[model samples]
Target: MTIEHAVPADQAADLVRQLYRAFLARDPGDGEVAVHIANMQHDGAMAAVSDIIYSQEALSVRAHAEPARPSLPEGMLAISRADIAEVVAYALEAARHDAPSAYEVELRVDDVGRGTPLAVVLRDALQPPQLPQESVEDDASINRTIEIMYRMALGRMPGPADLENWRGAAGNGGRLSNVVFGIGESAEAKLIRGAFDVVPGIKVQLAFEIVLGRGAAAAEVDHFRRMVDKQGSDISPLVWQLFADEARRRLLPPQHANDPHLAYIFGSRGAVTLADWRTGKKAVAKTAIKHDVLGFESVVRLRPAEDCVVSILTSLYRGGAFIRSFLENMTSQTIFRTHCELIIIDANSPENERAVIEEFCRDFPNIVYKRMDARVGIYEAWNIAAEMAKGRYLTNANVDDIRRNDSFEIQAALLDTLDFVDVAYQDVLYCFEPRLPFEEIAKRDFRSDLPVVSRYNLMEFNSPHNAPMWRAALHRDVGPFNQSLQSAADFEFWLRCRAAGKIFYKVNEAHAAYFVNPDGMSTRPDTRGAVEAYAVSRELYRKIVSPMLVISDEEFLARVDEIDAAPLREGRRYDIVQSALLALGTRREGVVA
Candidate 1:
């Protein structure tokens, strides 16, 4: 038993290409082929081929080879058991006798032999005596059949390009069966068929599972069935409607008046104290302040106190032109120059950029510049700036983003009127291009509708980060932003505020323009940030929310897992929080029995 020698180096490329096509159902790219060929020369042909076959891409293709199908048979007329039983009985009677009454047909199908073709039997029993057959090979008949096949397989009519492609494929001596089979085997066809194959009952159950993480109640199932019957054979729309309704229902804050959890968490009725361990005392701690913070200078000062402070964190040397724009926006603010103080926290910017900051500070009396000895991350810079703030209220200002002229005034006014509102946030207008005129960009408003902030809503969704103003006391009460978190520092702080029983008020007007930079930290996909945000949310849930609800630690953690598994967008960390809150509410009725 001698092992075969490895294939020659030149032929290994061809073998690699062949394996790629065999396993992945596509030709290998030039680069892929070259890499694999090199591997084959170093290892062996068999080893190279095995590696390609077991690769993630190849395994994904293989997994999709046999797409999932509905358990129900394709082209079945009746879905309900009674209807199916009647059709079966009629088919059996037709197979047994040449001419049978409807009553006899219903009675005889149960007695038919096991191996008979029910389709043929049903066709004979259902149809009248056959007339002279028309030629279905004609253009009109073929076109009509093609359209029907497209609908049955894809759940919709084919597009012009797809229709033409199919027509060309079938034009070369094609039969109707060949066209139908080709369409039926497609991935789109399989998915559509599978979706429709699910009975109305199962669809209702799936809707409940997807939205609320539970099975539908008997009443809910009955209601969905009624909806399905009204909509006829197309139950897909009904399923979507059910899912939407359930999502809205779950998102609506539970009747908080009687919710013991809300009372415990928010201390709405003074049911819990700030010193209680259950009221997030364990989770709230001051982030360790870095003593390495060396360079500190107030380049400008104003004697008459300001009501608000605009904290801007920037690495002026790295931020480039955006830093200038940030300074211009701060100076141009309608009320900020008079009513607010601008604090620029520079993380040891270059000498040239430091000169630029000094020039701005020299020109503006209200603008103050502070440089750190060492470069601290954004979260730390935020914390340091907050500590240096002199105003009664503080709001974060971004280098590349713009705030409306009256943003500070409006938020300050709102806070003044509402003493209970610890923080005030406004809607933001998102602009893709930073160069765009603020007036033109301000037309688009991204409103934060979570008006009343609670642990439940705050955990579920995050309000706009740079668009909010908080009372200085709230910051003092909540401590500083968690320096440990890289991306979700703002979110963690917001959670802390909510945990500390601080109420957030929503100012309906668009007060800021959030510029969307492809390279920006928040917009780009950060796996670590997402994972960290998730962990933060879970800990918040355990320390703040779980204590309020009648849920065990094990059950609460399990609910967090289910929420984490949901198909949530990575950037929308609040959605994950909301989902966890929804899950906790759903399980509050009973444990996972």
Candidate 2:
């Protein structure tokens, strides 16, 4: 077999990312198909499998293009049929070297059955191969099994083995936070958790909730796509209608059906006023525990100063309908009742929007509108709001969102802990303004799989649910949102919490309404340049990268992946993460020190 060493380990690691991304971005040929390599050569290092998928994503990513590896970019997939086996060996070499590396391997039948390649194998023979990640959340599926302990109390449940096939279908969330409802065959009651929390695919949660069984998953998807095509509307609406129709069909038939054992899966997507589940009703039994929201757990009030919120309100270039609803909902939350404040940065908004806000101020006296004439972005606007807040905590509200009545109550319960979270929020419903509903996104639990930008614990801060209520003091120690950073000032402030050694918690309740982009819904991390000042971030990075010198090659690869994600584009989770890892690896300054 010919040995090739054209690419360095780091670049090879990138290739691995692209490959893996391709796998995820597209549908597998069949569930049975596994992209096997010379696992025997690597001494059973199946870890290369992950590298292949990740590299595929990088190669497939393009400018202004839908992400997915449809056709390989130059050299990205130009693997010769012959080098396949060698690529597998290189994977082993990289693994043995304790670095993140990969190869475009092609294994011949004879090589797979025969002797091991020498020299390279002998050199690193003593080294132990790195294993797959063993994060705290690994036992998600098992943990979920425990959540339904009552079922087990009634019967003998084996373990993760019982859901092996299911475990394979939904990856991360299914594996960790895995829930097995006793619906139909294994029906459980009205226990709904955010399905999105379990998987990363835009629609994986849909797949997990809709059970035609894995075998029928593909057919069902095709059928839904066809319905959308016939409806002559965009995918997002089609997705919503499909869910609504399904909700009506399965969970709520026009007339009730015999589904006492039916496992109900709803979301925190739309606002859910949970209350007692009864028929005119008497109390239920201890055999089953019940939960429903009669009111909201959190309230998101747009407390922009007259200078800020007003400016945004009056900017009124195109989305006027959005503005009207925003104002209407402002005074409606059940918690605020009589009074609520509005903070605006004076010079921040367009003149006309400011005019409208001033008009609203007159209409409602409790509508306290404070303004800073100086031009500032979101962070400062929020600081202004916080300074003017009469309420104990501040929710730097999104301009487009409105809160349901009980919103504040649930969040208050969760945030009252000794360690207050930087912010707290639940998945909101994706609907137009006014009567918008919180959809399935609500029931999701983000404590696990928390993204890097939102993961904070002293020395670093993460932006939690966007519309969370924050203690005004956090702004004091965390400091005002840095004007240096434009869009990311709030995010950077969160990073500061980590610097100060603090952590954010989740309420597992959806409190507010957020308008999702019509095209699709997803968030982007801020690029270093987008921040008004990269100097501080860079300083943080520098301190981070230095001590990281001692980290192993594999860790270095992971760190690099995080840094490359530095672009503040949509899906920039990768960059922020790499930067953080670099910081962690290098922080010879142990106190964030």
Model 1 Cα lDDT, one tens digit per residue, 291-404: 111113422222344354444333232566576677777777756667777777777765445666677887787777777787777788777777877777778777777876
Regions of model 1 farther than 4 Å from truth: 1-317, 443-454, 525-527, 546-593
The stretch of ten residues in a row with the least summed lDDT in candidate 1 is 67-76
> Residue 342 deviation, candidate 2, in Å?
3.2
Residue pairs with backbone atoms closer than 3 Å in model 1 (clashes): 460-574, 460-577, 460-578
What stretches of model 2 exceed 4 Å from their correct place?
1-34, 37-321, 338-340, 346-348, 354-364, 371-375, 417-422, 432-465, 517-593
What would the per-residue lDDT of candidate 2 be over residues 1-593, giving only the tens digit for each residue? 11122334433443443333344444333221333233212412123443343343433443223434223232332222223333344334333333221111212212333443322322232235457786544446444544343232223344565555445534544433233333212332222222222212213224323421111122233223322222121123334433444454456444533232221122212221112112212342323313345434524333323221111111122233454556666655544433235444444444445556566677766555555555555555556556666655566555456566566545544455434465554544333223343332232211122233332121232335356565667767767767655455555565566556555665554456554433211222222432233344433322222223323233444666555432322222345456666665666467666
